[model samples]
Target: MYELKTKENDRSVVEFIENVESPTKREDAYKLLDIFTETTGYQAKMWGPSIIGFGSYHYKYPTGHEGDAPLVGFSPRKAKISLYFATGDTKREELLENFGKHTTGKACVYINKLADVDVAVLKRLIEQSVRFLQDTYPNNNTN
Candidate 1:
């Protein structure tokens, strides 16, 4: 059995944002908190030590691996902010075209700052990602 290291915890989201080394990043983190909260309509929750996540969903693979993950989240890292979304969603790729400046990784979108991206596009990405995950996993594990 494989264990998920980044399970959700009761840590303080505000405290985590307050401890960010860069003042700019700290401010951006607060902004992101507000964006994700208003867009997702879910209160922010700390995932693992760094990720500020909104709503959560449980996913089980055909190989029998199962875990709970946030519908959308972000982390204000040192180099760039990492945005988490559903993997393998074609809609995400399409939206990124008009998302302003950002780079895509295996499962995240990295951006230097909120200003470099269009907030409207970001909200759409959040909505689409959450919808895709809910439709794909249709289980009762969503919150």
Candidate 2:
């Protein structure tokens, strides 16, 4: 279950990313957090234990079940960094093509090392993805 933190245990996303042991990964996470939030104009919030998410959107299924979820986010994983730009196949390969070097698993883009990817291109991808999400879900962009 997602543990929603209150003012008592409030933690900033920057602090959470910095807590990671890896210097390179931590820096990358921090930089990406700034870049994503700035470009996407979305607020950053530390979700659950490790995810630093931006924006919020609700999904409605055919079965009438609906739920709210972060529109975009990333996590500093132990093995690699995971970038989240919503879910499913959003035909983001074009952006990925220009996203320098990285591996992907479904909706999450994984980078084994920060040196393997181009940071500028990654920023573009984030901006584009967030814009696309906001366009698709008019109510999600809270910037």
Clashes of each: 0, 0
TM-scores across all candidates? 0.96, 0.81
Residue-level lDDT for 42 in candidate 2 = 74
Worst 10 residues of 2 by lDDT: 1-10
> After TM-score superposition, what is the CA distance of residue 143 in candidate 1 from its true location, in Å?
3.4
The most accurate candidate by lDDT is 1
Q: Rate the local accuracy (lDDT) of all candidates.
A: 0.91, 0.73
Q: After aligning candidate 2 to the native by TM-score, how far in Å is the CA of 135 from where it should be?
A: 2.2
Model 1 collision count: 0
lDDT of 1 by residue, 56-77 (tens): 9888889999889999999999
Candidate 1 wrong stretches, greater than 4 Å: none
Candidate 1 collision pairs: none
Q: TM-score of predicted model 2? A: 0.81
lDDT of 2 by residue, 1-143 (tens): 34334211246876787688998888888787788788767778866777888776665668866556677778888998998875443557777887766888867899877678877777776766766776777864443
Candidate 2 ranges beyond 4 A from true positions: 1-10, 87-91
